[model samples]
Target: MTGSAGGRRARRLAIGTAVMLVLAGTNGPWLYRFGTERYHEYKINRPGYKAVNGHWDVVEFPKEYRQDTIHAVLLHTGKVLLVAGSGNNQDNFDAKRFDSRIWDPVKGTVKKVPTPADLFCTGHTQLADGDILIAGGTKRYERLKGDVKKAGGVMILYNENPDKPMTLPEGTRFTGKGNGKVFLSDDSVLIPRATKVFDRKTGRFLRNNPGYARVVVEAPKEGTRYETGTQDGYRIGGLTGADARNTYGIANKLGMDKRDFEGIRDAYEFDPVAERYIKVDPMNEARWYPTLTTLSDGRVLGVSGLDDIGQLVPGRNEVFDPATKTWTYTRHKRQFPTYPALFLLQNGKLFYSGSNAGYGPDDVGRDPGIWDVATNRFTRLAGLRDPDRMETSGTVLLPPAQDERFLVVGGGGVGESRLSTNRTRLIDLKAAEPRFVDGPRLAKGTRYPQISVLPDDSVLVSGGSEDYRGRGDSDIHQARIYDPASNSFRRVADPLVGRDYHAGSILLPDGRVMFFGSNPLFADKADSRPGVFEQRIEIYTPPYLYRDSRPSLSDGPRTIARGGTGTFTARRASAVRKVRLVRPSATTHVTDVDQRSVALDFTTSRDRITVTVPANRNLVPSGWYMVFAVDGRGTPSTARWVKVP
Candidate 1:
């Protein structure tokens, strides 16, 4: 004890003194509760593996994701990493059963990234340093049947530098966060609600030094609880800052939370020295599940989210000025559905990749404004290919000459009778009109398959459950690669775990791609075991490794089989970019590829490029079979229609 005021006097004390301490005291400014509590269990266990086939566009196809799935995906370097988890499993903490695995397209093998027991939901991200940073995520019990509230947000650092054999760094349990974005900063991370301070060097959630907040408020010398008329009851006046009440600001206008106004939150900076989270300025729209993209100019562009839905009122998009706490409305208006795909172009143009709002039959005549950043005005991008029909997902492709176009992919649309599309398209800005180019028909099945284009123009179409109409098979683990140059496909390794919903696909910096599946297998004739959800991750490379054989022609080419020049239905070697054939060319008029086959009504033929036999007057005409493929690029394949009956 020290005696002050007059002269400091040191008092002699006993030898030993014990000081009790609690761990939570270290990081306790904010308290948050997160996780699935409705059922006390998460239903969809397996997360799906995301692929940025060719250029990353399009979202999960409906037919493909009808099974079950994981969440987001990333394509880094060459390897693909997918986040998948299983809530039905007895051991929730098993990374093997939950984390991701790398698929080697070269070796044709799958390997897992070794991780801590609590590493589920696949929050791991690779840093520039080559170390994989497994950021905070929920923890499932290692052996327990039910979901338990263990650690909210914990970060486990791992290293896969050489990558030959991956390495898991030591674990440091960070107590405060739940589920949020793990932004890669210089050395540390700008983690949302990160309460605990972790030491990357020491590999531990440290409790030493000024790693905590210590409150020391001045106490008035009074009669304690029995005191009266002392203004001691707790005052909450400061919660509303003086500048907010005095200045001409929107906050003053929104005295109470209003339905008309967007609910905006401010940017907060965590001061390690003060151990406190200081609020700067709130975002324009107080939105959740929102997306923020950092621009080339270093400004973060926040966009599309469900702010005003029906009577509930959701958020649109607004920009935030970090220096000041004010929000600027960027005028991003929405109509019906709010889920849109965003793409930042290299040309410094912010291209909106979704639909122009108010689009019902009754709303078709209404015109929406196209955004022009230069004048801050909305103009018309007439020649632009908009995803008006299907809500398409697309990404910016980084190729040397790919500066003028965007590779757009997937979306669901009403098909003929019971048919639908799992195909992708492209928009070439290089063209004066920037028209859309419909892609080739996807492999036999629907959804679950993706297209990732390599530097060689070959696309890696991955995991999607397709219904084999003739075989009665609802799901197929088939994978294939399509070369645009040859317009042919070759089979690759299919996924062991079928992909379902909430699946994401990303392109890695390397060539290797990863696929992760979520939930139990929901494919047709699937194994409905309790823990069948693939919390597993696998990697994939192209199939060109195993076989170096050339893409041989199906036997040889000769227009229509012998016996006849086929129907020789006037056709030629020509261009077929955006043309959709609905009727056969009139025998009086000629067209591109000669049609060898025909139906009863030669005028309204549904199928194109068929092989037709000569007048089979000698015998009853043979039954017809649809064409599997054709040599459209050059020379003829079959000369006559071969009889099936």
Candidate 2:
């Protein structure tokens, strides 16, 4: 009886094994994927693997606190200011649901702040007092050609009267002299009085120069028949006597074409301590997608954006005086594409890196150059590879800002073209004739790569799409540590989340890097579903963090003036090899002109390390900076906040 039972059990086991094999054969792909994913998880989490390739962790805020963050700035208080401001959502903009959040990474807390305006696609930079100067934003969302219902375009209103300026109300009507079509202004227009011209050499009076204002106007009713084919003069309505004779409107080709996003003139300064925005003087020009760069004298330079009429700002730049809280037009006029990468030079000039976000004619203001802001003289630099593909490129002032070197990373063609380049260009502004030369190339053509300067002087270049806005699911998950000392890139761990357009990365005070924002065009390779904004912030822990215990810095001075010294206590001071004063980043849209790692001269004795800041104000702008002490093993201590006043 026992032998018979054993035989039956053995037969049953054989049958079960056969059935399992058949099931595996039918579901081979599913089983293979499951096994591969498990193995990958096991490999990446291993102690040895993490020590070499580092790791990435996603930080998802609570559902109620989640927002589509388009701009992020690291404040002196060690909290990140995430600004959304309608978040590129037409519905949110129409509903006036702007958003801002103060995220404390250390405490893992998120606080919602009331946003005053629609700051989407705005420009921001750190101020002398550690306040964030935020300028420009969306006034109206774009409407595609098919979506546009009314015939509308820019109408230039000319004022011939030299005695006074003219203010036209929102509903001001203009009737075309030729087409006989009537159009209404969408907003109030302030047209300055005409300039009375006189000959400079002779005392004779010359003809009056008309002062014009461009305003967006649309036909009251939607139809193809309302479109204008040629330039036409329009008669101003509700005007009499001299006003009617002096003011007239001229417009060309008013049609139901694609309407671009309009800009707002609103500007504000965000107080980090108070966690609120303080309204400041509006800019001279309404701008959308502008670049706010800190000037040498501590004033902020606002440049290059779509104007209130949805046209490119015509090279009219302005400056913001933080002390007076006023904006004044610059003595000169120079233009670039929107969000052009401009950096302050040691000589007080601005360096335009030829990297821009988008929206401009392809041939104009696209060259890398050294711009004399005061004189308005621009010396175009040469040797930039793939010059035509600079839109959406990432530019970085390489570590040790004193070197005056910059790196321009991957970019794509202007607008929605499929052209992209993997080339990385390096330019040494200190050279006799500054020009960009090719550096290491990326494995794949990339756009909107996030570059962060690490505490240890190595730059982490990571996350970009091979196509525009991550089209066709082309988000690159690769990350690399660029060694400036070697001028090479070493591939590191891959980021779990994909970052493309509208994405950026910031170096945290704790020596880690935090990445945020991604607005993809589609969800899948087939491009059927619309993409969602990546609200989950991802933190990258460098390989140095996983190697061994990091050094600790404490008891540091709060403020260290330029050319001054500050002492900090470190238990392992003798092991320290390098010190860096890294300015906190105000990053958005792959542009971060504020971030720079200035190498400091340091001497260690006993348990204390003293570091001296550079005297050059242009190199070390007056602001709060993260002081990091790196050991011989390239491991950096958690930063100590210090102010340069």
Candidate 3:
């Protein structure tokens, strides 16, 4: 009886031990399946579903934007605002075709709105509250008006009786006020008396005596103001509309008329959800061809650009205050050229990498350096191989936002040359005595490449061409991915359309990139000739989309406290290895002034995840960001918007 009982106990123990081992062996898979039920419910990993990698998909819009979309900004409401002011020509402005529209990619809806002013070639920045602050635009355009008669000897109105003998008979009178000359035609002697005679010596006019007036003299001075002479001639009380020359081309090749195309002092905020623009206080100084950069204090810095008079507004950098909805100028140390590539450093300094959209003179203001806004000082750096090629080049702040490193790639030659270069350079601003070091070269030389920072911290460089206006068959259809960790660039899929000149790109919320807008020379006009404005948009999905199962944030607070810890639940927390918050983008001319990716410290327990938010406003800034959960394989989940309050 004792032997039987012992054998039964041993059998029971063996069964219990075997059951424990099985449970232990299958624990990981079971927990993963339990946590990732939401991921599967979405049918993201369903059978027979082919997920493409690093592919470009062209999307059709229900409502096509008839006007060219030269400027684009991604709003926190998950809508993109596109603006093309005047469509690059005077005819479009006259036709009131300058437009602004909001595109909801998820619903495939587009809402067109009226643009108050010509915002073509404007500078834009995203405010902390997700409002867009746009500055500057083409107040006027440099256009060729119809030909005028080439008459410029000057003229003076004469009041003479019909019976009086003509002193200056059908000839030029070389003697007049201030030794000026006047041409007398056959009808000059049969003119009426002058009410006022302008004196060239004193630069003033004398009232004619009615009783003493009989035969009036024809002279260069003393005449009604007209458009027949130079612009100054009308201002000095001369023959206003007689045989005078207006502004004209300086006998250059093409013989195009030259006029001052000034920049507007306008500023405004665009509401993405409402698809409307609210006029804000105008900028203190007018800016055309400006660059808007977001600073650490949540104020937007407006730098560079031509003033109202078509002159460079140098040194005086303007800052937009959201609270006051006004702009304050910061007397900067050095004058930056128009659209200078300005990136805010982690240490509160501005780095001018010399990458600029060509607007000002080529000989001035392409020096790379760190500028101190408070002190108005610049710490210049050396070692750029081709500093002269900084015009229209593409520059980006590399991913892992904490790293104070930037890459400058591909630029055209100075001025109107349009020659592109494949040269690349990098600089680590945090390093002591930082200097630009050689980086990987591009497969094809391009100008105005749109370098978008991807969810996985990789940069997707797309668009651009080897020459201006994409001329000479220089449009590069291929796209490339830049890996910061590898310090290398590799070819990816190609986009359908060619983008250059006024083209732009923005990153969307769903881990996809939206590429839109391209204005070449004449834009969409009949006179645009061989040029075509790109109205269609293309969305690019990175290779990470086709990877293994992705994590999903099932629960989290919409508002996150800056420098505080927040708890959230991810359906696939087991696969999530890291957390990240990427700022929304406001992009134009390959200039994404506010795009940034910040890493978060996180810990996971089953389906629960807690993340530490960055405390420094300089690091994360008070604004809206797309919070993403990245898996071990570098695949990122569709982000959720989290506002840092």
Name the candidate that leads on TM-score. 2
| Candidate 3 per-residue C-alpha lDDT over 108-198 given as tens digits, one digit per residue, 9 for 90 to 100 | 8888888899998899987777778888998656433343222222233333222222233343332223223332332122233324456
The best-first sequence of candidates by lDDT reads: 2, 3, 1
The regions of model 1 sitting more than 4 angstroms off are: 1-289, 307-315, 320-339, 355-389, 392-403, 413-419, 465-476, 484-493, 506-510, 519-532, 545-645
lDDT of 3 at 408: 90
Q: Candidate 3 — worst ten consecutive residues by lDDT sum?
A: 247-256
**Reference-based lDDT, residue 613, model 2:** 97
Candidate 3 segments whose C-alpha is farther than 4 A from its true place: 1-53, 62-64, 144-257, 521-529
lDDT tens digits, residue span 69-126, model 2: 9999999999999999999899999999999999999999999999999999999999
The TM-scores, one per candidate, come to 0.39, 0.98, 0.76
Q: Distance from true position, residue 125, model 3, in Å?
A: 0.8
In order, what lDDT does every prediction score?
0.31, 0.94, 0.73
Q: How far does residue 96 in candidate 1 sit from its true spot (Å)?
A: 21
Pick by TM-score: 1 or 2, better one:
2
Error of 2 at 503 (Å): 0.6
* lDDT (Cα, 0-100) at 444 in candidate 3: 75
Considering TM-score, where higher is better, how would the candidates rank from best to worst?
A: 2, 3, 1
